[model samples]
Target chain A: MYAAIDIGGTKIAAGLVDSGGELLARHEHPTPAEEPVTAVEALLGRLMADPRWERVRAVGIGSAGPIDAAKGTISPVNIPAWRDFPLVARVAEATDRPVTLAGDGVAMAAGEHWRGAARGRENALCMVVSTGVGGGLILGGRLRPGPSGNAGHIGHMCVELDGPPCPCGSRGCLEVVASGTAIAARVGSTSAIEVAEAARAGDAAALASFDLSAKALAAAIAGTAALVDIETAVIGGGVSKAGDLLFGPLREHLKEYARLSFTRDVTVQTAALGGDAGLIGAAALVGHAEV
Target chain B: MYAAIDIGGTKIAAGLVDSGGELLARHEHPTPAEEPVTAVEALLGRLMADPRWERVRAVGIGSAGPIDAAKGTISPVNIPAWRDFPLVARVAEATDRPVTLAGDGVAMAAGEHWRGAARGRENALCMVVSTGVGGGLILGGRLRPGPSGNAGHIGHMCVELDGPPCPCGSRGCLEVVASGTAIAARVGSTSAIEVAEAARAGDAAALASFDLSAKALAAAIAGTAALVDIETAVIGGGVSKAGDLLFGPLREHLKEYARLSFTRDVTVQTAALGGDAGLIGAAALVGHAEV
Candidate 1:
């Protein structure tokens, strides 16, 4: 069995997963917004209390990044109190087992590549298009977390040279135009879910907002395809739940941007694992080193 | 020893290279423009006529792309007559040695990673920024040719979603804005060399043109860094000869674009191999499979 932990802005989740990618036990706790480290420790304690913890051979932790896998540290954007936190060392000390670490994006890709839509794909980009867009890459049939564990940080790539300024200090980043936050901001809606509801009701403003986000996503995806020669992209998260509202326009815009011969046949697919992906991916990271 | 061939739109050059990547003997011929295959065969025959050919154990060919390494075929954009031409099969038949094929960009990167600016770097981007921009990537201490061998085709990556139309049918590609052709067009000059001369003479328009191209290049480089976590970018080709006329502005803009912690330290260096990168890189391809 593998022990998995997922550190996010709002929640700390832990689970015990078997070799077959099955989650046998799980636990979750709301993240202490101002003090996430303490919450992580508490969540770890709760998970260890389960009898299955003794069966765990390795522990894998997936945290929002920028993570330094070499240094075993993480500094998630939404968690102000955890800048450069030594996650791997602390977790290994607490669990008393060998530990592996990866960025959330990397974890997500690992999970999908191991058992989700990206399974059997030699090269793919798996993405989480939530409040902010996040992603990981599978290259040469292996999940590549990159040296710093940020190989698939596609959200920050500049899709527009002169589009708009992003909070990450770059202009025209894909996240600024394609994330759920961006989609809501485009239609002046409170949330992407609300915008989706409006679009379902035939609201032109909401539909156009989704289209704009899709256009930016298409450009970024096509650009990635050109750079790495990936032919498939698996998308998940709240914004992706909008279904055809996003994929339809995304596919349409992809046709326009992915015009190069190698990139022309690029395909988009919905992520199959949903919210469980982070936990499943964290578990998969325990074995990823062999790949 | 290895045999290397570089097939460009205007020239077909072949060389005998030692295991240490030293070019022993070489031959070249201008491409027939409309009948490049014949020129390539003639160049290969001349290269084999050298006594050094007896020492060669393998052959590597780097050609203008988009090349289908899987199919052992080439369909260069500039050489329309060679669509899906089976260059690898023909070369292998003539040479009677195992043959390897890669895009020119991949060859350039392999050469640089083997003996040039990117020699010791674990992850790097090696580029040829000429009339058209091209590049290849080194990841995890090895060159990655990607599935179709176009992994480092950075020129086609869109920096601007709504920028300008490229002949490849994409808008705002890095090549559309940062290629030597683009730089010269910005200054109403016939060539980037002429623009460089004018900029050296303190022409304001020429200086602005270089800056604009540098800014685009900086954005694309930063974007690539964010996507793949590469810290070093080695640039070659005619436009890179502009020196600080290009590097100064690129470094300045990189500071504004590469703001993420993992991407913040991206360093740009001039490619050390120069024009011979393609040849040496083609030679490098013979051993890339083992990596």
Candidate 2:
């Protein structure tokens, strides 16, 4: 068994992952968001202290960006206390096991590539379109974490050249257009969940927002296909749960944008694994390395 | 020594290349454009009959696309006489040599990556922005040709969300905005060469056209950086000869589009090799494989 940890802004999760992509024992606790760096490490320590960790051969961590896997540190935007924090070293000290780290997006892609929607695909782009969109890549049959371990940060890719400015410093970033937050803010619905409900109730404005978001996503996906030559894109996260409401328009727009012969046939599929994608993918970082 | 062939719409070039990226013997023939497929093959046969061919251990060919490199066939848009023509087999039959094939863009990139501007860089993009914009990629220190061997077809990547339509059935394709053909058409110039001269002479419309083209190229480059995590882009061909007139605006616009921490400050450089980029790159396809 391998121990997997998924670190995010709101929560810290730990699991005992088996070879079959199963989480034998899983635990989670709310993150003390306003606390200092030690508070988060303390939560990780408590989780590792669980008796199941003794059976683990190695530890894998999937943290939010911007992670430097080579340096074994992370500077996640959501977590303020940790700036270039040595999460890998801390985890190593806590677990006394070899620890592997990758950005959360890359970990999620690894999980999908190993046992989820991207399974059996040699080249794919797996994305999570939630509060802030993020992604990971599987190219030439392996996860490409790039030099900085941020190979698939697709959220920040600018699709609309003259589109609205994004907080990421680019104009018309995919996250600013297609993310759940973007979808909710399009018409001030307060939440994407509410927007989905409004769409279900035949609100033309709500439906239009989803359509607009899908169009931006299609442009980015198409551009990615043109550059990197991918035939499959796997999308997950809260906004994706809207199902056909979002997917219906996404596929339609994809046809318009992915017009090249090699790109036109690219298949877009929903991510099979749910919330645990981050945790399972973290485990896959080690699993895949061993192979 | 290796034998290299570069086939395009207007010319067919042949060269004998040494291990040090030198072109020992070189010759070219204007393409008999209005002739049959046999005429093109005969030209290739005549070139291989050169006394220099005796020392060549392998052969490489870079052809216009859309080429099915795996099938050794080509269906170039400009070469209507040959639709999926068996150029690879015919070349092999003509010279009895082990042949390797790649798109012209990939060949140019491989050439530059092996010994030119992209040298010493693990991840880079090499592009040719002549009549049309074409490109190739080096990812994790290897050429990525994708499943179709057309992995870096950057010309068709749309940068403008609501921009102009392109001949490739896509809206705002990079080629439609940044190619030499686009530049000439944008300013009603007889040729891009003339447009460049006019810009140097302080023609307002010509200057604006170049700026527009630079903006589009920058958008595509920025988008590519965001997707693939590349920090360097090497540009060549007709339009690139404009130097700072193009590079200055491109770098400026890139900063606007490639705004993320990882993507910002992407370095743009000019191609080192001149007209022979395709030939040397074709040889590199074999040279790199041997290493």
**TM-score of model 1 (CA atoms):** 0.99
Across B1-291, the per-residue lDDT of candidate 1 in tens digits comes to 999999888888898889898877778888786667788788888878887778889999899999999999999998888999999999999989999999999999999988899998999999999989999999989888988888899998888878889999988999999999999998788999999999999999999999989989898999899888897999999999989999999999999889898999999999998778888999998878656
For B261-281, candidate 2 gives per-residue lDDT tens digits of 677868999999998898999
DockQ of each: 0.86, 0.68
Best model number under TM-score: 1
Cα displacement (Å) at residue B69, model 1: 0.3
Lowest lDDT sum, 10 consecutive residues, model 2 chain B, at B35-44
Going through the candidates in order, the fraction of native interface contacts each one reproduces equals 0.84, 0.63
Q: List the residue pairs that clash in candidate 1.
A: none
Q: Write the per-residue lDDT of candidate 1 for residues A80-109, one digit (tens) a residue.
A: 888888888998898899989988988999
